[model samples]
Target: MNLANIQDFGAVNDDFTNNSVSIQKTIDYCAALGGGKVVIPAGKPYLSGPFNLKSNIELHLEHGAVLKAYPDESVYTKSAFRQNMGEGTIWIGGENLNQISITGGGTLDGNGIFFMGDELHDSYELKPFETIDPRPHILTLVSCKNVKMHGITVSNAAYWALHFIGCYDVSIANISIYNNIKVRNSDGIDLDHCQNVRISNCHIESGDDCICLKNRREYEELGPCKNIVIANCTLISTSCAIKIGSENMDAISHVTFNNCIITGSCRGIGIQNRDEGTVSDIIFSNIMVECKQFSEVWWGMAEPIYITAYPRASHDHKDAGWRLKPGAKEAGIGKVSNITFANIRCKSENGIFLGAASPDLLDNIRFNDIDLEVSKTTEYQGGYYDCRPCKDDDFVGEQTAGFYMINAQNVYISNTTVNWGTQKPAYYGNALYAENITPLILDNFNGTAAFEHLESIVKKGKTQLEKIAN
Candidate 1:
C-alpha cells in the first residue's frame, strides 16, 4: 500500500495549527505515487482551511482523529470549479475525479456556530450576507465517478453537510451526521443530478432534510437524477426526512426508499416539485415515521407524508439559486406521477397531504396499508397545509381531514387506517376530503370523522368515488 501520513508532511496535532497545506501535500504525494491511502492519524484535532481532493486517492482517518474546519474568512476563497454554489467555502472539494473515497470512523467537525446570528427564541435565524449566507458546506464533490463515502462522522455543518453533484456509481453507508437542529439549511445529504446511487445504514439528525435529491438549473448538463435507492436509515430532522425537490429543472425518476425509521421530524417524506421537472416512478415502502410541528420559520406543518406539485412565481425569486431560467423553452409547470407509498406506519400532528396546483400536474398515486394517526402533541399551531412557491395563497388555513387530496387524478388507497387523537381542534373534522379528482378509490379503509357532527367523507367538484367497507 502506497500510504502517505499527514504527520509525515509536517501536519501538527493541535487545535490552532493550520494543517490544510500539510494535508494537501500528503494527498498530492499519494496521487503522485499512483494512488494510495492518505491517513489522518488518531489522537488529536487537525485544524484545517479548505483543501482540494485529488483523483485515485483515499482519505482515511484513524479512530479518534478529529479534522476540524478553520472558520476564518481570510483562509477560504472560491475556486473556478465551485462557481454558483452559494457564498462561503467548500471545505472539502473535488471536481471531475475518478475512484475517490473518504472513509474511516473519525470526525470532520465543521465549526458551524461561528457563522450563526442571534438566536430568535422562536426559531433559528441568521445574519444576512451578500449573494447568500456565508457558512461552509462540509463536502462538495462534483462530476466525480466511482465515489465512496462510508464509516465517517460529519458534525455541525452550517450549510448542507454532504453534497454530491453529477456523480455516478456512488455508495454511501454506515455514516453518521449530527447538525444543530436550529441551523436552518444544514441538510444531511444532497445528491444533485446523480445516478446509480445507493445509501444505506445511516443515522442523521439535522435542521433540514435528512436526505434530498435534486436536479438544479445550474447543472442542467448533468441531466436527471434517477435509479437511486435508500434503505435502513434512522433519521431525525426539523424538515423532511426524505425529499425529492423544490429545485428540480430536469427529470427525477426511478427512486426507491424503503425500510427506514423517522422520528422527531417536521415532515417525514415529501416530494415538492416546483420547477420544470417530471418526477415519476418513485416508491417508498416499509417505513415508520413520527413528526410534529415547529415554528413557521421552517416550512413544514408536521404532515407525515406530503406530496405537492406547483409552479414558482416567475416574478419572484428570479435571482434565487437552483431556479430554471426565467423563460426556459420548457413550460415551467412541473408534473408528478406514478408514486407509491406502501406499508407505512406514521404518527404525527397532521395528516397526509396531496395538493397540486392543477389536476393535470399530478396523477396515478397510490397508498397501501398505511396506518396514520393524527394527534395534537405540541402547543404549536396546526390545521393548515403549506404549498409554497406558488402564485396564489401559499397556505390552506382550514384543512379538516385526515387525508387531504385536492386537484389530483386516479388516486388509490387500500387497507389504510386513519385515527384522530382525543384532543383535536375544531378544524380537524372529516376523515377524508377530496376535490376535483377524476377517480378516487378507497378499498377496505377504516376511519371516521374527528367529530360526530362532521361527515366522514366530503367531496367537491367532479369526482368518482369507489369504496370497500372495512
Candidate 2:
C-alpha cells in the first residue's frame, strides 16, 4: 500500500463547485495504483459527492479538513448502488472492499439539514432534526471486511449516521454522531445483516435510536447478524437509546451492549423482536439510565428494555400474524430467548417497564442486580400530561415489574430495587403484577413505600400457588 496526498494529486480544495468528479477520480487512481492514502489537507474544506472506496485505501482528513457536498438532487446522478439514496448524494455504499481505514480529526458534514424531506422541514423549521433521513445516510458500508473508522465527526445525516449492511469484521471507534431531533428517522447508527462488528467510545445523539439493529425483512433469506458488541457509549434521543428491530425476522443473535450511559431518551434501552423476526442471546450489563420526560402507556411506543413478538400489519395466520390476536396459537417466525439484563440502574421521570409475550415462543429472560427510581415529570411528553405536585400521591410499581404478565412465562427478577419518589396516581400502581403467566420467579425484590414489596404482593395474589424457584 502507498500514501497519496490529495494535495499532491491535484485534488481541488474549497471548491465543491463542479468538483464531484475530482474526488472520485482520485479514489479510482489510488485503487488503480494498488491502494494508498488519500489525504485531505489541514485548514481547507473540500466538496464532493458519493466518494467510493476500494481495497487497501485510507481516506485521511487532517485536523481541520472538511468535506461538504451539494444538496442538488441532480448532482448525485449515480445509481442506487452508487449514489446517495436522496439527499445531497454522498457516499452510497462500501461493498466487497477490504482493509480500509477512515481516520481523522476532521468533519464530514452531509449538509443534510437542507434535504430533510419536505414535510419535516416545513413543520418544525426552528428545531434540530439530525436524525431525519432525507436519504439513506451519510455513510453506508455493505459487504465489506476488516474496516476501521475512527475519530471523525458525522453530523446532519439525511438518514442514519452510519449504516452497515452485510459487512463483517468491522470496527467503529471514537466517532461522534449528532442529529437534529426535528429530523425524522435520523438514527445514529444502524447495523443490518452485519456480523462480527464492534462499536465503542462513541457519542451518539439523534431523534431515533442511537444504535439500532435490523434483519432487513422477515423472510428475506438474509444473513444472520451476530457477535457484535457496543460499549463505553453515551446516548440521548427521542426513541429507544438502543433499539433492536420492528423489522426483524432475519435472525439477529449474540449481540451485547455493555458499560453505557444513557440520558434524556424516550426509553433507556429497548429490545423489540416483533412477530416479523427472531432475536436471541442478547445481553445488557453495567448501564446507567436517566429518564428525561416521557410516558410509556402503550406497549408498542414505550422503550426501556422491551421485547415484543406481536403480529404485524401484513401478518396472517400462516405468516406469524397469529401472535397479534389475543388468543391465537404462537406463530413460528421465531422466539426471543437467552437474554439477560444485569447491573442496570435507571432513574427516570417514570418507572421502568419490561415485558414480552406468552411462553412456548419467548422465554429465558432474567433481571439481576437492577436498581431503578421513578422521578416526577415536569412537562408532558408522548401525548401524556404529568400533573403531580411535590407532596401528591403518585403510584410506584415494583422497579422490576411494570405490567402484569400478559401471557409471559419463565420470567425471573432478582436483587432489584424500586424507589418511588411519588405515590401512584389512581390510575396505575402495582408493585408487580403477573396475570396469565406461569413459573414466574421473584427473589430478593425490594420497593419503597409507594408500592408494596414484590414478594409479599405476589404471595397475596389471586393466582394458583406453585413456585418452581424462590
Model 2 off-target regions past 4 Å? 7-18, 76-92, 117-136, 218-222, 294-302, 315-333, 355-357, 381-404, 423-428, 448-470
lDDT (C-alpha) at residue 406 in model 1: 87
lDDT winner:
1
Question: For residue 262, what is the lDDT in candidate 2?
Answer: 92
Most accurate candidate by TM-score: 1
Could you give candidate 2's per-residue lDDT for residues 16-127 as a string of tens digits? Answer: 4644566667777888988888777777577666667788888887788887656654455443323222222235456778988888988777666666544442122323
What is the C-alpha lDDT profile of model 1 across 1-470, one tens digit per residue?
Answer: 69989999999986788899999999999889889999998897898988889999999988888898886755656531246635455889999999999999999888888777877754467767665345788898889999999999989887889989999999999999999888888899999999999999999999899999988777789989999999999999988889989888899999999999999999999998888788999999999999999887777899899999877655545334337574543327678999999999999989999988788888999999999898888888778887765545678747647898888998999999999987798778788888888799999988898989988888888878988665
Model 1 misplacement above 4 A: 79-88, 318-322, 326-331
The TM-score between candidate 1 and the true structure equals 0.96
As a whole number from 0 to 100, the lDDT of residue 117 in candidate 2 is: 43
> Which pairs of residues collide in candidate 1?
none
